[model samples]
Target: MGALTPEVMVRSLSQVLSFILAIALVLALLEGYVYLLFFRRPRALLGAIFTRTVQSAIAALMLLLFLRFLDRMGLIADLVAALGLAPLLTLPERVWAAWSALSPMPWRLLLPFFLILALELLIYFAGEPRPSRLGLAYVLILPALIGISFLIIIPFLFEVRLAFSNMAMYTAQNPEFGLRYGIENFIKVFTGPVAKDATFFEVFGRTVLWTAINVFFHVTGGLILALLLNRPMRLRGLYRTILILPWAVPSTITAMAWRNEFDFRYGLFNILLRNVQQFFTDLAAQAQSLPLIYDLLAWLSQAIHPVPWRQDPTWAFISVVMTNVWLGIPFMMVVILGGLQSISQEYYEAAEIDGASKWQQFRHITLPLLRPVLVPATILGTVWTFNRFEVIYLVTQGGPQEKTDILVSSLYKAIFQFYRYGFSAAFALVIFFILLLWSIFYLRITKGLRGVYE
Candidate 1:
């Protein structure tokens, strides 16, 4: 390629600036729309301020694009120094005039100053007319951040506004929702499913039970496995590899695999069942003279029967709990193994010198020392298992009957299958409170909070 000409660079800079100005104009228009339509500000100043800031930001972007297009990174810093710091430049006085006149809002000065500073940073990073290799890739990043921040801020504000109102789809469609503000949604969440005639207390109780049962089994099973593996035995490595496999595998896959294994017929369990024909043939052969064996067969025939493990209530509950408990152990085992290794061997040695039994040593020394690890893990496991839907859903589809359904799946069914989104949202809010209250109660009870630096 021939050496770059001044005319080519100027043309590129013009195109970049034009593109930047177009985007700025669009953003300023959006600011006015959001302020007037969504926020409904009593005064127009907020819209004007937002629009002006956005326009400035756009201009900064244009400058950087020009520098980057011209491949002149150093030129940008030099220009900023020359323009920003030149003697008797009158730049500060011009900037002060822009700030004062840009918005007649109460925050006019503060808003414009921050906006101008933000624009300056955007230009410095973008490297518009001259490109730094580093700055070229990042030229558009600052404006993008600003755009994303608007997305979050606007939605969050609207949601908060909605929280204080009785708005719905019909009302949200209009610029001014006809519905009035009230505390009814909050009250409704506490009272129960208003349409179903069930009280909120009932659902809350169900959630509490659900959380407790899952945590109980998870902790018990995990502790048992961890204890077993900690002991020295033959084939220890192989045993650990197999035992840890359940947690290493995805819970969704494991749940489904176990589900198929529990099928009533044509499953592994049923296929392994002893054929009655063999027993009958043996009985016939022995019947000619073996009275004692005949008597034993008669006795044994009355004792055992095939269990409908998933079909029946007692065993069905057991099956879900067992599967979740099994799924949880490997994670706990891995975490607990670290905790166990950290225990000072000196404690065990002292206990042994004092003639303490292994059980006594564990109860006295290990349990207390393990509390730090166990307490946090227990809390996390409880919360996660309470909301664990995939494992249980994939396992039973919350079925045989609805006996195994927990709050999360039940809420999902209510929303998706029944199309009661309003009710489900209310229910979700209730769940949030229940968890919050539980966490607070836990802290009060245990005095263990997050990031306790000491």
Candidate 2:
């Protein structure tokens, strides 16, 4: 788009104001109609209905006229043009195209809406058993429900449809959708190279390893910090604030900063390593008669070489993992700290009185009490880390021959880099199902929601 000239800015502002006013008017009319139907309880229902029908017809006619006036004045077209959008296929036009494409299967198109309407009717009649209470609850949550339907449910349904199609860059506009296409897509995902020589199973295995290593460190590091913070200390608040900085910063920024720090030369890690190696060398020189010092210096010289973090596959994987672990630990520390504080001190006191040692007290009292908080936190942590894309993308971009590519990053590359829409959709579904099954199993094993239900 061109630079925002004053004329364009003023025209855009006017269009926004006009759109807001139109929506406000429509909402006001809806509120009045709902008040009459559910709150006011008009004595003559048929008369109220007739009045509302006539009012709605007039309101719709006026809205159409208003839109026509804007079109005649070229305000709408100007806004579209200023935004650098195609005038031929606006958002509404695209929606209309999608709707037309589904005209061949009218039942399929209307099934979700019909199901939602039926669910609402069932809830209205069968839930609460009070009209006012049901109406109030539905009115309060209707906006959220509508937002989810439009933003999440509709897009998910579209993805599922795409998964069943033979869509790619060439046939994105018109792709054949069927069971065979879906099967082929899924089979291709497993049987073909996902990204330049990286097989599906290979990427999946690497993803699992990445998640396990990161989560392990996150839990251990966070637990240690939380435990220390739980004790009375002079600089407790300051330490907590400093420790949480990694989590407080945006992940993208942190990932980029860490990526820079992993550079082979002039990077923080290599600089520190070089300094330590030099210090050891100087010490060994002074203590030349000590054979152990010479052996230690030899080990340091071998081990403290500047690491090729992004060049070597193993170190590239390690670099991303280290970045993610640092980024993830603070969150877990805060969560575990909260869980730790919520445990009653009375349990620990009683355990001590019973002659229980510190380890016994922790194993029996602390672990059991913190189960409620830790279970949910771990589940959430697993899900977030599993789908984490920013650190992997920013730090390594699944580089070093795609050795560090996780399922989500691979799926992203498939769609955006390779333009294999159908294949990526199928791959996404596979990832979703894997997480879903793992969550269900973990919940069953941990009985995480038992306390909530109780």
Candidate 3:
């Protein structure tokens, strides 16, 4: 390209100044609109416009000074050349380029600021009276809802788009590659070849089973502990503290420790089994004269072998469940304990006056009262256990040939291990819908929320 002439430089600088002045003019108009329509202060509107004009003029001057330095250093032309825009650039385009190079104010921030101001103004003008606290709170909350849309809802929409598009590693690297939008990924999740061995249906079933079993144990164990702790007993606080320690301990550490203990050889469980086997063998030798006793003893010796806790599929599933139960029970206990505390003592006292047994009191008063608390807690526990990846992974690593792989862990493997981004996105959405529908169904069936609200 030929060198930038003095004429081109002068033309570009004038365009830049014109663009900045146009922005200042827009801001003056906006300030007048806000002051008159919102503030209803026509007398102060000119002052506001003047203040904004001065600020914009100062900003424009500073931006021009910075652009001049870049122009003098020949950086602007170099940047245009590097970006392959040199041949296409007009004087106005070059001016805009210089403005953009300095990363002038982003619309993301300014748009929200203006939007919030507009909302406040609308609320202010809605009624003859000044806006109430509730109106102001709603106006303030508008930005936060926008923030949630960006943070959560936007990524979800992106995932949904990926689910429909062919977004594998190849497409990720090749921008020119056309994304075929279809339900092919979703189909692949069901009856495709990959689904034959560890099908989505199978994994989903296992996930439900895992959740049901864990939640069952968590509630039962936690309820038992909470009941014991709620009684008037010695060192009750100490007992509660000690029982809660398992939960306070980091889950990863607890999982690892349990994994070691479940080892087939030289582990605590196996070592104890071996000791029991040795005792049986000794007892059989001593009972040789009593033929029937010796036979029973010999059978007992054979039955006392070390369990393969992690290597076998069923055993590994059980091992992960055990670890998760340990980690989960404490949370259930705390939640149930809180519910127990909220129950009225008068109900129990009335039951006792009626000569109701302890079981009757618990059955009629405690369980009914605790339902409001436990129902929601149980739902949350079920969902958490459904997605419980750490304990399962840390303990069993979804081992025994992926027999223990839950839906979440399986999707994780699809993304990281297989690099099947589109497939994983589809899988994730499937899981999301399943959980969503399940939650809706559960809440509808229980109608337990009505009691809480009442």
Candidate 4:
């Protein structure tokens, strides 16, 4: 019993079945006509294959539509989708296996006719929610929820479509097949300038450089500091605390602090330079103002001077990389320090007994043992730096010109600045595959065949 009774439900469901039958019949007839008109000549050699595919597809649609109508009509009251009780969908899949392929329709479809007749005679009046369960609404809405699974699969198909197709509607006249977009975009991604005049590949390459250089300095410097702090020296606790201060401070604050410190005027750097330049004597001579790194470049370019640091392309690139390296170091230092603590003292003692030089011990023991932790950290650091926009953008703004745009920042420009959703989506899809392919390649190379982990 429901707000709408079983009788009312059956009446409404009957009408729905009639409506579905009409639609199905119309579509089948229309597609059949279209196939007769257009799909005829292509069937010269593959006629059997084409016919089989068409017939099989059509039969499947018909069977699903029939099952759906039966479910609607309360001919099968179990509503757990393919798991529904009493009548099941497997009847079609199973019984159809024995039917002749050449037949117009599967002889197995006859089973449904008798089954439905017997169903109507039996308790066709049974209701849902498993008959004893409390949630009738759950049962009623179950199929709609199942339908959404297919809905979620659509965007992936669209991305795949774009990946394969040239995608410009104006490319040619009514092309039957997907046009040859080629690996041109893919190649462009790795080369330079993905779109228009701006070169994102160079930006991305610089980003990678930033990552590698940053990690190398960070690990070495962090390890040295960590080892120093680990010793039983005076004020060791205070020194350790001071060393970690850079990492513990918020990144934005640290970045702003560095930005101020690098200012052209009233900054420590210029003051220090002026003191050092005056033969280390004129501590009281008025400290000369050095141009800010970027400003200095513009000034020098005016005077047949050194290449620009922030405006000239090469200098601008270097400044950004240096800043990124500076920003990234503290984090790596902390991670390495943690890794160092986890290594056992026994290895070092054993190395000493074997009369291995410190360098030799480090080379053979430290590096090989550290590889397990460092490899993952290095790879993660690489990806993070590759996509790092905030640090570079806040500092460089891709300035002088659009000379410093990485793939992601460049993608941002395309989406918001250029209003190219499809283009950007395609770019994102490409990047995703690039990362996915790299991951797959790494996994294959690494062969993550774990034995046992507690």
Candidate 5:
């Protein structure tokens, strides 16, 4: 009744159609450029590169244009309306009427169809399909490449576009929002008022610290447990099950449970500490000779109040890290355990004959052998912990005054809470570059991807 009036929708549809036709026109020009490059010039290495680039670019443009055309064409809507699909079938007549009213964009859809048809005809008259291995590969691979391009590359391009534009919530709701491209969003991320207080650098450092601490503990704890479990011992299965139970539980539930346990007053942790303090007090009082124990207990109990784990910044950070480490270890433990089982016992036996101690055997044989498996697992764990949002959010909500806010959580706040889409997108791109650079550096340093040959 309000904004669903036919006139408004028709205008919006007109604008959308105009946008599509414009894109189609551009694609047609690019296709013509491709034809000129290959058909007119004798084939050369430089020309081949140019031709390939133009072809790929034009193909991507056509695919995106086709999708937008189909969406605006209301093909899905028409099919659903005809078939009376579930949920749509149960909708009231007024809803259906409104949908039908809003769906189509007049005869403008014919523009793209005719433009494409003309391009195909031109190509058909100019040349026939050649049967080459390269052509065959293109036929097989182009669909998958196009799918990935649409799924990943296009959205990434959109994010980059959004980063450059002033596309906040206001502009987001308005389809005719004008493009205002500048480095303003990037500027704000680094030097704005938001950056002045708790700078992006600080958040980034804390994030690095968070990732380092969590991964260190996860890798070490998991490796230790994995080693223990890998040994031939009785009740190893039971120990493994009990150790891995923390990871078996969902992270949200685990975070909530840990949050309660970390509570300051009458929480499980404090209660247990109080009981331990009481036990020590009783024991020291009964043994009158060791009065230091009684005095120590009195002083300790009086001095150490219940920790405000979630309310204090340092403790809040520690709380989430602890919860994450617990959640993360079991996965690494399983990975390292598998690596350990795959190692030949003959290596250890030979080491034993060479008078190598257990530590020597582990240092020489175990670690070297486990490196191949652990390297990629470590990288995956590092990336996951770097971007982990759930534990941080659910545990402390990035508080005691945003002290624990990592990049991803900060991005969530900027975009969802503050509606600063452009700024958040810029911030996200910075994070992406940081991670990308680090990953490249890490892979180069480790050379983990070396093939079986030199």
Candidate 6:
């Protein structure tokens, strides 16, 4: 929290260097032991020992340099104090305090490191005779694997632990963990309100509807535009660029802008509707002699009144869906466009020669060929839309009596708003399983992976 200074920078750099050197030294010793155990030739053993000695010497020297640098920067005392090693404490007291601080014995951290070392040894042994590329692949991907473990897998496991606990604002300091707590959390998720007044089924049903509507419009609208752009046309690039602007802009910004545009009196939608109604009224009066035309214009005028988009629950839901659909279309269009272009012109030409209509060609050829691209895109789109929170949160915020709350937004509200940490974790797991099941069912039904594998 303190301001960055030369001393802080030097200390941080020294800590990082020391840690890296320590790891290098450990790895060198581990590899040397593996070599001694595996290689029977005295030459190989001597080479391995020499390599380990050189690596260990370099790492130790680097560690010493970092220590000296930290000492010179006057940061050694600060580091010791940070580690709870008080100057007044006897050596025994310091050791005891350090042991107490590490009471839980970070097996979670050590287990992974040891497992990785074992895996590397196995890979090395396997690859020794035939120089397998798999070891190189693992080395290249090790950083990403570590990142995913820390960022995703670890957090997911922690959330599962929370889901099994009775943790809330009241019991945050000492939450009870048990199978019974997990059962209660899951049961409450289904039976009790997720938000203040919205039940789990109600919010979930709305989320399904929301995802469906947005995905439907996104696919259809993007496909239509892609089809048009696929044909020969002047300024097609310009038109495509303009159409994609909604997606190019950030969703939060677009949602806020659309939220403003849904304003009753001053919004662009209302203003346009009001102008249309007035124009229709004037036309109806002028066309009164023709009763049919007059009635049509009058009806048009009556139907074109400004809507209370934000105030009404249904309208607010519609507003968020519309914003999301707009925000989602460009991605679909780009994906579909690529798929469309990938379809060989020869197929269309042969279909045309066979007297197939446009629709017939699309149904018989284009769709089947595009399935490989479209199915994956649709699945991704569905998942993204189902979990989408920005538009709803920014636009309506599950407003008008929590009417627009989806599962994700409701989960967020439960945690941050209601302080129902345990409940929210359970809610999150439910949503995850729902999406997982849906993806599995969808893939099976669509044979989406078959196309990819084939």
lDDT per model vs. reference: 0.62, 0.78, 0.74, 0.57, 0.74, 0.80
Task: Kindly list the per-residue Cα lDDT of model 3 for residues 13-49, writing each as its tens digit.
Answer: 9989878865654454445333333333213555446
| 80 Cα displacement, candidate 6 (Å) | 26
TM-score ranking from best to worst? 2, 6, 3, 5, 1, 4
Clashes of each: 15, 0, 0, 1, 0, 0
* TM-score versus the correct structure, for each prediction: 0.58, 0.77, 0.72, 0.52, 0.70, 0.73
Clashes of 5: 0
Give the per-residue lDDT digits (tens) of candidate 5, residues 1-454: 4758899899999989989776656555555544443444324565455545645755766555555443343323445556655353334344546655765754344554566556544444445343344444444454466568767876786677667767677876432212354477787888763322467878888999999999999999999999989989999999988888988888789889988888877568777777776776666567667677767766765665567786789988888888889899999999999999999999999989999999999999999999988888898899999988899889887888888788788888788877877777788899999999988887787785575345
> Which sections of candidate 3 miss by over 4 Å?
1-135, 175-181, 193-197, 448-454
Candidate 1 Cα lDDT to native: 0.62
Q: How well does candidate 5 score on lDDT at residue 110? A: 55
lDDT per residue for candidate 4 within 1-454, as digits (tens), equals 4597898999999889977875554544534433332323322335445544555655675667566555543333335344763345545544556554534543334454444334322221221112324344544454455456335444565455544444343532321223354354444455645544676556557555666676676667766666555445799767767776766777677656655544445544545554454432232222234435435444433444223345567666666666666666666666766776677879989999999998997788767777766766676676777667775566666665667666677776665666444455567777777678766776566554342231
Clashing pairs in 6: none
Between candidates 2 and 3, the lDDT winner:
2
Backbone clashes in model 2, listed as residue pairs: none
Tens-digit lDDT track of model 1 for 347-446: 9999999999999999999899989889889888888987887866787766655556667776766566655444455566667667898889878767
Question: Which is superior by TM-score, 3 or 6?
Answer: 6
TM-score of 1: 0.58
Q: Candidate 6 — which residues are off by over 4 angstroms?
A: 1-137, 446-454
Q: Is 1 or 3 the stronger prediction by TM-score?
A: 3
Write the candidate numbers in order of decreasing lDDT.
Answer: 6, 2, 3, 5, 1, 4
For 1-454, candidate 2 gives per-residue lDDT tens digits of 7898999999999889877765554444444434333433323556445445644654564455544444443334445456664443244446657877776655543563455344334323332222464566655555566458657875686688778888899997667778899999999989998967799999999988988898889988998889889877799999999999999998889899999999989889988888888887777778778888788887776677778888999999999999999999999999999999998889888989999999998899888888878877877788888899789999999998998899999999999999998889998998989998998898788876776699
